[model samples]
Target chain A: MARELTHGASADSVGTRPRVAAQPFLRRNVPILALIGLLVVSGVYFSLASDTFLTLGNFLNIVRQSAPALILAVSMTMVMTTRGIDLSVGSLTAMVGGVGAVLMRDGWSVWAAIVVMCAIGVVAGSVNGFFVAYQGIPAFIVTLAGFTAFRGIALILTEGFSIPMRDERFVWLGQGTIRNVPVPVVIALVFGIIGWLVFNKTPFGMRLVAVGSNPEATRRSGVNTAALLLRVYVISGLAAAVAAIVIAARLGAGSSNAGLGLELEVITGVVLGGTSLFGGIGTMTGSLLGVFLIAMIANGLILLRLDPFYVPVVQGRFSWARCGCTPMWRVSATLRRDSF
Target chain B: MVTPEEHEDGGSVPGLDTPEPDDFVLQASDLTKSFGSVAALRGATLELRAGEVLGVVGDNGAGKSTLIKTLSGVVAPDRGTIFFAGELVHFSSPRAARSLGIETVYQDLALCEHLTVARNLYLGRELTRHGLPWLDDRRMARSAEQFLERLGIVAVPGDAVVRNLSGGQRQAVAVAKAVAFSPRVLILDEPTAALGVREVEQVLDLVRRVRADGVGVILITHRMQDLFEVCDRLLIMYEGTDIARLTTKNTTLEEIVYYIDGGSGREHQRAGSITSAS
Candidate 1:
């Protein structure tokens, strides 16, 4: 079937029918398949190396630790599908958390602080969106400015200090368990499901892919491409804020130093999950696996008594190795088109 | 040679109280636009009757594209008037023109390569379930199939990604997208610019099918032979102004080529103009 598509040399036999034979499930999802294989191999290795690694408690703990990163990664998928990046997310997380912490310490209601955090997220995202969408600035440049500016604001707000939380209920959002599942895990699952639905079943999701694929074409089709791009950045920012709240609750403090270099981790996981860095292609399922893979690797490395520092090194190398395969698929697809 | 006034009267005339003689569906008169120092369209005018295929042929930079852009509302003209079914209208954007039943299939086809055929067909205008935010993919796919079948476009399935389709199939999908809306005025810009011999025939046949549906089609092309094959009348443009309009039944291919080549000299212009106006 692949050969038939690649070579128009046999046009006579195939006739004018351009009906592409449906690719088998495995063939269509090679990246996801590869990730699953890696997971199994790594799971086995970890299970043998550390008896505690395969335990249900350890698995739940991994989910809890990775919940915040997963939340950010899910939104990153949406942004990247529009061929956009949000370097500001890490810093936005810190800023939102720091501000929320300060507001709570000042005797503000938790609901009020949460609302304010979301508002800050919207404002910050709108600014980034305005420059990238309305002002025609590149997203990378706009978000890079946002990254520095937001982190600075967070540091200034918290006075470069960590403020401990006194509200047990607010902290419970992170540390509490519901029906034997950690609250953060449940939240992550909800986010994952919502992200999948929005990415696959909504017009907003389809337009993101279209805008990334061909902005001019989409604009010509009467779509407000600028607004679509703005919404994408806002979603990223909003998700970052939500993640920040979860992190703050877990830490029982709002720290200006939280989520440092977190943007790279989220981006790496999204890319590793088969969402193309170039945009126009994204998979929520793949992202889930990618985030889990990273978190598991980190946990297993610690359990194996390996230097905790090797976690980043292994992650960087593993992502490089996995993402390296992505371009090969893209190249072959390009070659097939060029053959025509 | 056929001046703008020589055709049917389409522009607004206050208190005239005279019904238009020609069944003209769309008309653009004395349209002019300039980008910085370069004038793209200078006094370009044309008329389209319902169920007629009007061929717009020109050399490179002849402003064929610019004139079409103005008519389709892609680019606002700096000066001119457009009449749609005898009502003077202004198009603020392509969406406005589309809402008024004018659909343009640009040279690039405006298809999202990563999306499936059904998805590309309903890119911006999506059908949601009970007007909710969720897409009605099943219904859209079903309707997409019906649309292709109605156009006699075979072999392309709704589920197939656009990137995998051949060039001809992609063109077919673009045309189907325009026609599915049941547009009154269908403008095709260089639809056959990038296609094999068979593919060109398929697109030309599609144009014929659209024309038979009583839609006014303005086809812009550089290929003289294609114009003769599908167009009812030819509007020849040169140096950003339409210089001649000729009926296919009355003019030879040589005559059309002469106008496209600037009619060479003043004598030729006079002769060409006289022939076209007559």
Candidate 2:
């Protein structure tokens, strides 16, 4: 009976590839190409517009300025891949900076303060994870509320003021570089590599993407979805805290506004790097490229003597265009008519 | 009713038929579950023999899915006993069920569309080399190729992302993943419901292939055509109750439907009158 069914149905043809194979290639590579094109265009424009733009000093400055944002972008990449968002990253960064500053003022060692601040960041992120993953709250809502509440806590703690660290060791970490590379850049690179390995090579990374792509299926496949979600949030929180340390060290102080609006830049970098906002598609390499693209844009605008405020507006517009156009082009270009 | 003795030899032997011993791979007795006031399952009993495809069929809301979830550890039964390999087992989580060799492939196929075929096939249990414990791409691709070839699933590049594959191919990959661990009992819920006629055949062939590998299959499907094609025995559930059990050769679809629609008396009468006339 089974053989009869097979013969009857086998006539329909078994191994024919779908009509369109070129679409996947375009879908995967187009955004990456676009990002590279944008960077090259901007780099050329800036180099022609300003004598300082192409210098090694300016390039190092760009890397230093982009390090915190890059770290946060890396964190966002992991969180968004799991179909969750961390709106509280900026606020969490500020809070960590505030705590570290307070501890430094109290005569704590620079390394000791850094350790305590990072621990606080993990705890804060874990709390966010607990509410979102364990208590079943939407990540957006939980982190959105956290965005305001944590920022308020930071502001209140600092009395709406900035506190400077006069400690030589801490100041050197912020202002000094090792072999012409800023310390923050080094830290971001190390963490970025670690993040990449964790997401790509480890079981934890596999489960993160699996849960993000299809939570129900992952659960059915026997994964603990809540645990994975919780871990992503915690990682995001730790990233934010690390960003705060970088920012504080660079400025030689912890400001209440240290990472204000940074979440937007980090998220922009992630999206610009081809990480989908709807989740389940992205790469650390893309995110790294994205951070550079956003940073270069801001730096280019400054070099052209444009108001820094316009940077955000231009970045916002670029993100909207990318978000609206890229996925549509991908869908129409790659997927077969019947597949949709 | 037919005597067990008449079909014993041709019956595929109750327990020793396969290499496994006489222990039931999975056994559920009087399993009951409810969602709020609605009873999804009530006192459903099932015994899965090694190397057999036991097909379950019923209309909508007949609790077929609930039973599969309970056995696969997706849901904790409100009442009853479950035994696996002759030891009483309570799966507090789905992971527990998997550890005990119970894997399920839901109709949605439970695949990550963004990931490649090899990645999806090895999502939970990926092959890893000694260094760094990273996803051993070469090993995974080789194993995935072998698994697909063993099942006769063709034309799929091992590195192709799942989203790029057709619906049938995705289903095939899901089934392959479930069978990757050599699960003792493979539970496939509506394995071919969404496929075209040809796709359905491919899935049924995969099901038969799994059974031939000495893994008992609990196929929860509503299609009578498929039931007759691959199932060794027929189990009819109605309103969360197991109303009839018969060998596929001895029972008819009409009788199973009658039992499904709560026509036990009419079913008995039809069987009685047919026997008398014969």
Candidate 3:
């Protein structure tokens, strides 16, 4: 019987080899599968609902519209993976765009203005990182303070009005397309690829996950967890700055309300992508799909001739529905209940 | 019946060459620890030699865990001198202790169950590819496979998540992770407490394999059968003090039990008289 068991085991092992091989494949592909399924169902529903829904022009329009939120979603994923939230991303975007527009208006070259804008974003993010990571403040509270204070700063810079950049070079980056793809889309793709490599291929990526999984374990493992947490906030800041630049160029003006409520959108994208809000489990691809899913849902809803006011309710309901399904939300809820 | 003095000098008196004292790889002298006014450990001392299994048996709150924590640097002793490989050192933290090749396999296993067996093995100190600071997943998995095989731990897939492994396998992985550090001293807390007979045997075999590699092991348990089966020297702690130190070969279970249960003797009489008077 032992010999037969061994023989049977080997036979089953060889026969069911794909089962073992598919383990990680299954784990990593669940979000992707869900993404594809959602897209297919939505595409069919929207196509059947409206004659103009499936057109290439409308699809391109959706890409153009979702480009900014998608870029911000990438940054949000990095911060969220480390179990952090950046509510100030929207304000940081407005601050960067407002400051950059004012700088360009004041005789600064387009490239120099872009650099300054991104620097401003990094500084804003670093401040948030410093207060949260070093000062040991809750991210929600720190970013909430940033949400109000940074927007006030943006309003002060723009004098509570829109600032326009007339420079053609600056406008081209926001509005131009290379090889028929919008510059913002290309930029978002670039950020996505970079984010993917950083989160998966580097020691920093491993440490980020480690810190998110269990900070004490990471600290005991001789990793400087504080520095890692700081770096994620910085990345989120840079991403917000980049998104701000794109939004400003596309609008041809920077307003205090330019990137308003973006925190909700980027967070929605990340949560929908299956990146746990609780920290430790997420992927760049998942976040990307999440952004697209949100974009598609919005676009499909519009094509279906739905009331714009009802759109948020539908999307908000969907988000709440997903709260119970995702592992990250469940884990965070459990941690909160247990710790409290 | 051999007297205590005869037992101490038996190896040298006629037949046995007393084991050299210098063989000890790690030793603690007059270890004392207290949390505020409550004394957790008092004048506790133990020694572990190269390639030897020393079992520490004690009841709950008897300070066996406290002593292990002190040695592993999870807690600092108020007064004690720790000599590791003949060098006096003080470990301020568990990381410092681990850097000096002293690893503690905690009861919780201290493992991230969400990670794979290979990842758990190389959780802290991962193998990185040359010229790049990225983790070399292939190399780590291969090394984990080799280590598990050396410890005779079978049926565990290299990429299998630790949560999927049985309690015995998890313990094996935890031990493997500690041994991978190449620590001169390995402290295990109740390694086989929750295992079945077959699993217990597997863990014991792994412990023997660890000792064979010349690592001194401190096995903490309450099981007399386990101590008799595996440990060479037995140290029994009762009420925060090492009351009796015996060789497994020279002592019987009844005597050890008597010492463990506070053995109705003069010490008990003095305590009883004082309590009655109070």
DockQ of each candidate relative to the true complex: 0.28, 0.24, 0.21
Q: After superposition, how far is residue A241 of candidate 3 from its true place, in Å?
A: 2.6
Model 1 lDDT tens row, B1-278? 12223222221112211326356799888999999999999999888877778889877899998998888878999999999988999987777787788988998888988888888878778878866789878667666765675565445777777887788778888877777777899999988776778778777877776676677899998777777777778889999899988777567777877787786766656566546534
Q: TM-score of every model? A: 0.89, 0.89, 0.80
Model 1 in CAPRI terms: which quality? acceptable
Top-down DockQ ranking = 1, 2, 3
Instruction: List residue ranges in candidate 3 displaced over 4 A.
Output: A1-28, A55-57, A102-113, A123-127, A130-137, A320-340, B1-24, B27-47, B73-83, B86-93, B234-278
Ten-residue stretch with the least lDDT total in model 3 chain A: A1-10
Q: Which has the higher TM-score value, candidate number 1 or candidate number 3?
A: 1
Clashing pairs in 3: B11-B16
TM-score between model 2 and native: 0.89
- Worst window of 10 by summed lDDT in candidate 3 chain B: B7-16
lDDT of 2 at A1: 5
Is 2 or 3 the stronger prediction by lDDT? Answer: 2
**TM-score of chain A in every predicted structure:** 0.92, 0.89, 0.87
Compute the lDDT of residue B50 as modeled in candidate 1: 76
lDDT of 2 by residue, A1-340 (tens): 0001111122223244433242456556777777787788779988999988999888878888999988988889988988888999999888899888988988999999999988988998999999989998988999999899888888987888899888878877668889988888788788889888988887678778788888877777777889888988888888888889888988999878988888888888888888877777878877888888888888888998999889888877766766665867577646553564
**Highest-scoring model, DockQ:** 1
